[model samples]
Target: MAFVTIRDVAQKAGVSITAVSQILHGKGRFSNETKELVRRTVDELGYVPDSRAQGIRLAESKTVGLLVPDIRNPFFADLVSSMEKMLYEKGYSTLIGTSAEDVERQDAFITTLLGQRIDGAIVVPEGAESPGIRSIIDRDLPLVFVDRTVEGLDTVPSVVSDPYPGIESAVETLSQLGHRRVGFVSHSSLESVSVNEREVAFRAIAGRVLGEDGVAVVDCDNTFRSRKDALMELLSEGVSAILFAYSPDAIAIIGLLHDRNMDPGTDISVVSFDDIDAFRLMTPRVAIISQQTADMGRQGVEMLLSRIGAKRRRRAEHRRIPTVFVQRGSVGVAPPERRM
Candidate 1:
């Protein structure tokens, strides 16, 4: 199929290409009839404006690039949906890319977004080192980091979850429930500023509640076998309750418990990050620490918009959405035999 250009729309609508261009962009004085004619012809011919070409001429794309790591993660999925909706409401289109937790893939997406001359970018960076991200910064492209941030990118505005509130509440709740020894399970394979922060927060909070000797931590990959091994490791240490820094690991452990016909509440109490639907739907609902996905998305976009087209970039602003802990059936009384 041949591509329909502005010239085609102009010819069909009985107008000059300049008229069609101005009419499409809502610029220049044109008769109402002419505007209607061009629009009708465009719809008839399925002529889509070349935003890239227009962006080059106008120095604005009215488009923003968003990059995330693994959209399959429910948290990221919700963030993406919220951001896209807000962007659309603001009369901008979203260009979304996913890295699937690969640094090289993340770089490739950044390169692609740059090639398209995106007006700005909101990134959940893959890591600290990336020529692509560095280039965007050096070029002074409007950028905001969300969910996670990279080292040396402090000058870039960011919105991330503050894990202290939720972690503290969770550990204190467990302590009140007579859980003397508790465990934390973290993803050993993935590294990020936010992930590390959650672990750090959990250690400090859990240590205070359960004491140094009473707190145990297991770091494992996302595999089921790894998660199972991590769970067994904590159980062997006589931990009556556990917290997961990563939600997928928590979900996996719950599945493993189901297969063995073990009660999550009775055999082992469970709490994890992210308020994904699956957690709520489990046979025994799982308690969660929610990072407030909608708020993160809205605030990240607001930061990016503030930086875009500013005469002088202001000192980068930072925002944190406090995590909230939700109590559910997954938490129960500490097993008498497992109590320290």
Candidate 2:
């Protein structure tokens, strides 16, 4: 089939080609009603904007890029969905890349997005630092970090949850339940924003309550089998309860416990960092520190748009979304001997 062009849309809308271009590009002054009319006409005509032509006109591909460490995880899935929805509403297409928790893959994805001349990007980095990220910043591409942040890159905007307090609360709850030997299960090293912040908070709180030797830290590869093995190891070390840095790890540990004929709440307490939908439906609902997934997405898009509209660099912005702890059945009192 022949490619539908701007002229086709203009003819259908009974407007000049310039008007159609302005409406489609979201440039210059155009009435909202007229914009809607042109959009409808374009849809009716099955018009697909020529991205090459768009690049020639605006020096941008009119595309936004998103990179996530793991798309299969529910938290990342929800985040990506929200971002895509918001960008779609603003008349921008999104290109998504899954880095699979690998720094090399993340770098490749960044290069590909930059090659495509994406207007902006939202990245959840697989590593704590990357030259690819630096390259984007050097080129002054509008960029935001979602869910994670790096240490040395101070100029980039970031949207993250304040994970320290929630970790502290979880540790305190476990300590109060008479759990002296408490353990933590984290996805990766204490370098990425979420994992590092939570681990720091957990260590501080656990040190204050249970002393240095009382805390056990286990690093897993953010996979079910790896997390299950880590949990089993912790359990063997007489850990009465475990704090999971994310929901996927918590769910995996719970499943492992069930496989061993142990009840989650009664046999071992669990606290998860992020709350997903399925957590509420479980027989023993999981306790969680919930991040505002939708809010993060909306805010990231708004920030990027603001930067794009300004057409100049503003002071670097770092916004932290608050987290809330929800008590559920997964937390219970420790056994008599394990009690503090």
| Candidate 2 accuracy as lDDT | 0.80
* lDDT tens per residue, model 2, 275-330: 78778888799888888889988998888878767755798899998877787898
| Cα lDDT tens digits for candidate 1, 1-340 | 2235677888898999989988888899988988998999987875546646642324577989999998999989999999999999988898899999888899888867765667899999986768778768765789999999888888889999999999999999999888999999987477788988898998898887778997899899867789889988987888888899988888888887778777888888999999899998986899999999999999998888878757787899889999999999999998888876
Clashing pairs in 2: none
TM-score of 1: 0.83
Worst 10 residues of 2 by lDDT: 51-60
Q: After superposition, how far is residue 307 of candidate 2 from its true place, in Å?
A: 0.9
Weakest 10 consecutive residues of candidate 1 by summed lDDT: 50-59
Top-scoring candidate (lDDT): 1
TM-scores across all candidates? Answer: 0.83, 0.78
Off by over 4 Å in 2: 1-61, 189-191, 222-229
Query: Candidate 1: lDDT of 275?
Result: 86
